[model samples]
Target: MRILALALAGAVLGATSALANGDALVIGNSRYTAVQTLFGAQRVAQAASALNAKGFDVTLVQDADAADMRRAFGEFAELLDDDGGPVVILLTGAFVHSAGGSYLLPVTGNGRIDEAEVLMQGFPLDAALAILSAHQGRAFLVLGETGEDPDLSLYLNAGLGELDIPHGVTVIRGPAMDVARYAARDMARTGRFVRRAAIEYELQIEGYAPQGQVIVRAGDVAPPRGAIDPPLPDPFANRAADDVAWRLAQEADSAEGYQTYLDGFPGGVHVNAARQRLSALNAEPFYRERRAEEDLELDRNDRRAIQRALTILGHDTRGIDGVFGDGTRGAIRRWQEETGLRVSSYLDRDQIARLQAQSTRRAAELEEEEKRQQAERARQERVFWRRVEDRGEEAGFREYLQKYPEGRFADEARAVLKAIDAQRAEQAVGQDRRDWTKATQANSVAAYNAYLRDWPNGGFREEAKQRISQLQLDADRVRNSIEASREEKAMNLNFVARQLTERRLEQLGMKPGKVDGQFDENTRAALRRFQDARGLRVSGYLDEQTMVRLLAGGIIGIDR
Candidate 1:
């Protein structure tokens, strides 16, 4: 167990402390009547001697009774008041666990260990833990043989296990479990390693076997990991952020030191006091600037503007009020540091002008950037317009304007629409001319009206309208004269037919409706009846075929 303990000791996770103020409370109670002698007194006395050799303030109690154990815990809690250091607890004895309560068996028992009387004389583990937890420090509880009691769930449930993170308490049953647990979280996170031979040599002094059945309940952050060799101290441990923060907060020195301290340990120990001193140191430069500015007739609002400007440049001036404070001075120094200017807290006239010039320069740069973007946009628009023009379609032109207005083909599309309209106008003019000439030749009122209606806006519309008006007035008289001419001709024909055609009609045994010579409506009807009887061409006029058929019928036809 001694060998295992030392082996585990070599790989302590938070082994940074010198433990200068560390107290070792080693208790060993072997003189028990109701239980087996656990030989715990010999083991823990050895552990106490080892701790004393390592410079720990050893508090040993061998074969302690119930009263003595209680007094030891009280002194332990008191000793922790002055120094917030590591507290090592070594317990080797018979432990009682019943009704979910844990206790350490005392040597001065009057009855059997199982009885309530003897149990009342034992020390409560929970009470000791409560007192220990009151102080702000690290605790390492090293337990001896368990016999059968597993009531160490008190420490297990307190987030104590193999994880290397800080905890209220850590339980180390033996050296193997302690070292193995440390090797897992630490080795997996950081790949630094230690030699196995060194660990074996360190732990061999305690006469422990190489047993490793360590159960770990390292909460949510722990991943399933294979075993790994223990590691040496981290190479960059001294320069770690926590270490630097701890150091800077502890020692507040120059103005820069305090500023650095605040940067590193904003919520660390003694940080509030460090910041207060830093604020005072920073005020020196701010006052100097204020007095100089006042003498130079500068308004206090200028400092406020400068603070705002510094804030824009990512420097934290804390606030933008006119009274420039330590925070503002520190921000000024930071701006100077970043800008490659001479590092100082005080701002002179030239320095303020240079700092203020950055804003002007940035504005000009942004304006130039915007103009460059506009030019690029126009260039892209031209390229897209050219591609759309290659398609040679109105739809492509319309779609292109949706993306890039006033495209290269926009003017050409207007020209195409104008050309189509002009060509259609010329074709309409030609069609109107042809229709008007046809109406003039026909000399009919209906044809002229049709031309006027179909081509209301046509090229010959005026002439068509005038001709239809004049032709309509004479149309009735012309129709009447034509009817008279047709009646006179029919009278002459009737006189001839009456002289020669009536007797032929009587011979054909067909009524010629009065046997009149004129081809009147009744005579025409009789001719149709006679033609039908003879299978001759039917006619209501004295056509050549009717004349031939009449002659063939042995009738004297009109020779004229």
Candidate 2:
């Protein structure tokens, strides 16, 4: 309940537009009698400011009384009207989670509040999600509980509550779940980490639609550069660290805005160094030189590059006019910090040369690295299959399938199996020698086939090439085993497959006849009909290829 320090700090500017764009509220309810409330207040204020500078509409309510807490919740509920975003809600307090539900004692309230005052003293997850759903935004609830607390799972089992992240809720207990931890992820500029943690649980719920909507990551770690950016407007209420990191990693503009962020935040954490490095590069004449090269194809030359450099430096470039005039130079210098690089408007050859070289190297390195990784993966796959053949082919293959479901060697394995089985049939009397020789020559291929035969449900699957290799041995007895499993195992239909089949049949002149909970012959017929109408190859099967086309055609409105 220590969110009341706003009285001393003055009402911080609520990033009205930023808040409205993607609302974030840092609620530091430090309810412990030992820990001072001001600590939570300051942390919330800093977090809110950091997020607001990054274009988030943030409200920092520190050390709030119960009435103030309720009012803040109401304001947050209003933010969901237009933006389907994640409204972050942080709580730092004593969490009394009984059979009824988990509750956070308001900071100003006494720690001894009994069960009778649970609803009044604490905010419930259901009420929070309901409010968030009504507002069109997601809710992320981060509960940083202190001291010796009961296991939340107890409450969960007793029907008090469950931590269903995808419903846009994340519940974290223990004083270890601090504002600094979240600040670190945000500082590291990783939001997907936070987003993933928020939504991962609900994504696994029995009947809940696993939209895989939120990206959640926990901890102070930063993701590798150029990793997939988290989805924007994260649909959760209170995000963990990754959410904060991702929000702060966003590019910004204006000297004043950046300076305000720096002022409020003295420590140069995750992004501070990146910002400084960018600023140093920006101040150097060569930074503009690289931009000029990248923009050389465009009509504007030096102007565009200069404007870009200035923007990167957190300077406002009215326009990239090519002319390195006073306005542009002044803006660049204003954006400069403690970097030793001399402030200059003119693009110098040395700086330009270095940036161009670095850029070229980075681009080439990225491409080559991608190719190298792909090749290495291919090589490993070959090796893995080879080992599988040498050992228990079926076991090797099964394990491989589990590890690499869409592996390239999948087809080869199938082919090897066909060959082995064929050799067994041709020389059914003494085909053992052929088996040893084939295993030695094409171990990976042999392993793959064995995997397909035994562990039909294994992660790795046979591709077109492997199936083609097995084409000659169509009548193999193992084929029946493979086909039999697909037919009998009703649970084989993946979530994507089920949704696609259901939605497509519903749209077409057919009412989805009992999603009969399985991919049976009826489902195949429906799939074939849909494929035939679309002029696609209709094999009366829903293969990955078919699923891809279905997705491309927007057969089902589910976001990919």
Candidate 3:
């Protein structure tokens, strides 16, 4: 049991020595739920160290329950009374007195230390006395320091007054170690020694009760290991402007001692005094250099926690030793840069917060950008297909296919190009029919031959060949008829075209009197008769209207 967070009042000079211990028995019990348990193990460690230094073989047990503590005390009593230096049985825990017995608690004791059954569960002073009296060794009984019950001196007087021994049984109570009841009251005697001054000063400090190791110096052998004697020799007692800093840096052997002192007492209450002394002792350089080195072990763990947090934020701290070395500094700087802060090798609370904020923002931006790019790509695809469709030709389809061979509409574009080529082929066939019709109306072998030449494998190729065969036999005949018509024996025809018209009119019931390819009088007379019969003015010359009507009436065998 020890003071919580704060250090105890030091020895006036400092505890440098103690009475030599033979076989020391130290029992620390802190597991009581009914009362305050021991908060820290430092006191137990300190007591053990002091006794071990005095050449006593020390056995320490902590957090022990009732059975384990009883077993320990029984073992202490067994080895304690017989064959060693005077025994020091130091017990540190919760203490209570009821029915004239002092009870030192263990981990599992029911209710309060004052109850009779609870007293049975604890290690009592009477058991300690029985063992000391049984061994031949004069024993010193010690109640060690704890946070609760600093004014517990009456537990000793009440318990011992009921025992069989003389007042020679020396008892010690520690760091608070008060025995004012034995010295100043009815249990008073010239025999008991106590820390009157330190105890008085400790009582003045608020909140926590003061308790310390006690010593009994009545025996001529040596002083016992409790707080009855004056406090031990302290190296930093004279250096104490502040009570805690000396214990922390000088006494507790902690590196954080100086730094923690400076942080808390920066108003120059303790720091300025420490600095003045540092120069005189030439310890300034040592502290300056080892300040970080001597920090609490927890500080290193703290650094590792910070590094792990940074790692989660995507900054690599390289290692986690809790020290802010170059790698850690660089990580901090990088994080500061990413979060849009001034680049630096150090970090404070504000920088860490912003780093997290900026990381979140960057993630959101990247997601948004991805969505935008996807939409743009889709729009481009739409435009590409539309351009290809609006042209609606082979080239338009081919352009789309070349650009986007694996595009969404690639197969459809191929199908469209095939359809366009088929339609063009069908249109070319219709033009071939019109050319054949014009050749048939010319009614000459040359015209028929020309039609066959143009459409060698066309649908009208057979018809053109048959007409050419018929016209080739009349080449001489047509010339003779033309000669006759021009001599006025028959009307002259312009060519075979007029001759064919005369033949068609004659077949339709007009006497043209000639079947020659010339614009003769007979051909004109037949044309007028055909026009008159067909409800037109009998113009002697063939007219455009008459030709159209003749062609429409199938009199002219031109292709429809």
Candidate 4:
């Protein structure tokens, strides 16, 4: 009886070793150091237990930092053997993406995830895809997205963006809660058809998944006699030929070269790497120009110099803050187009030097032109003063002062005009002086009209007519301003739109105070300045035309 019990123990231990079938890595991050915590992300840890039950080696981490996540990936990679089997990786947390690729972010970074941080710290989805590609038909990646849309900096966006899936890896993605439930219950179940489960859960499945594909089988089932299962082609069968072709392709390092290799050996071991390089080469049309600019390794001061040069050349880089954002890129593209160069929106070393030289030349030319204009203006002022001095009339002196208020003979011109006005006043009658004084004191259209009626052809007749004209114009302007205010109110812009308007005004250097969606005196002044600059109606209110120009196209529906 003791020998039989020992034999049973040995059999159990042997079966347990034989059942080890695959490797799995599950990382679920819920708490964050900077941004809002993703509440349901940590629940995805249940998937680790489910995968372990299916005879899979699982490594699970929760709320992992960058170093912790990297170590987990390395450990998981070491578990993979040459013999292909099922491979599963599940990641649930904040995600940010750019044109390059999607990234699974760790919980320890700042809220504003820039492109540099993403490349250095974030776990690239493409790297996971590359690893999965080696296993072909037996690879799976499940992504659970926390629907928190934090503001990622310039080139990054919040969410799992569009993916470039490899040839034979399957990807399943959904919201964090739904993905957690699906991963534990259906995805880890033995003998479950992944496609049917995905359909039932309403999850999005992408890349290479055929019908009836199962990750784990129920048990070993023998086939009937003479019924043969088709064998998958071995990835390393023609290693010598594949190696030579891959070497030639890498040496060429062109899209066409990679394409030739792919066409020759579709199932080769280096196929995944070749496809990744090919995709990157083809994705950006100006990849060479962009790479050339990046190779310069420009510092902040260098970027600011480029912006100053662009602005001096009248390209309007928006601001010279040393950040090459969309405005700077657009300015660069425009400058390149005008200078008869490639409009790639990226500047090489030679281009930067040329821009600096052109700006320096332009600055000198502008200075010289300004000096010439100043000399010419002085000569014209002298000639006009000579003509006015020869005439010596009140009208001539007034016209001379109107044209050049600070001319060389301005004090002489004003003295002579004042004396002429006093002599005219002395020549007028006592009652005429009294009536003109009354009209001037009242400073109204009716009062001026009364003064004109009392004394026709009086000394102040011209002055009274001018005053009436200005008063009438002022009345008309007041009516128009009131109508404009009503029109602005009718639009009924919401609080968020108001905030956006204020923010845009601030961006344009109008100095709208606070930007709290409250239209105060400062905000109105800013709106007026914006309107005045743009040649719109300067009523200190937002009309359709003002809104269009201020927002730089049209009123956008801002999310609250």
Best by TM-score: 4
Cα RMSD, each candidate = 48.6, 21.0, 46.3, 20.7
TM-score of each: 0.26, 0.32, 0.28, 0.37
lDDT of 4: 0.68
Which residues of candidate 1, in runs, are more than 4 Å off? 1-19, 34-37, 109-111, 134-137, 146-167, 174-560
CA lDDT, candidate 3, residue 136 = 41
Q: What is the lDDT of residue 341 in candidate 1?
A: 77
Candidate 2 lDDT score relative to the true structure:
0.44
Ranking of all predicted structures according to TM-score, beginning with the best and ending with the worst: 4, 2, 3, 1
lDDT of each: 0.48, 0.44, 0.48, 0.68
Candidate 1, 502-540: lDDT as tens digits: 667666655666655665676665655554433444444
TM-score of model 4 vs. true structure: 0.37
Model 4 misplaced stretches (Cα beyond 4 Å) = 1-20, 31-42, 109-115, 220-560
Cα TM-score of candidate 1: 0.26
Q: What C-alpha lDDT, on a 0 to 100 scale, does residue 209 get in candidate 2?
A: 24
RMSD of 4: 20.7
Model 3 residue 190 lDDT score: 21
For model 3, residues 73-122, the per-residue Cα lDDT tens digits are 66555545344455556676666555556667665434334444455676
Please identify model 2 stretches exceeding 4 Å from their true place: 1-11, 14-20, 34-41, 109-111, 135-138, 148-161, 164-179, 184-191, 195-560
Winner on TM-score (2 vs 4): 4
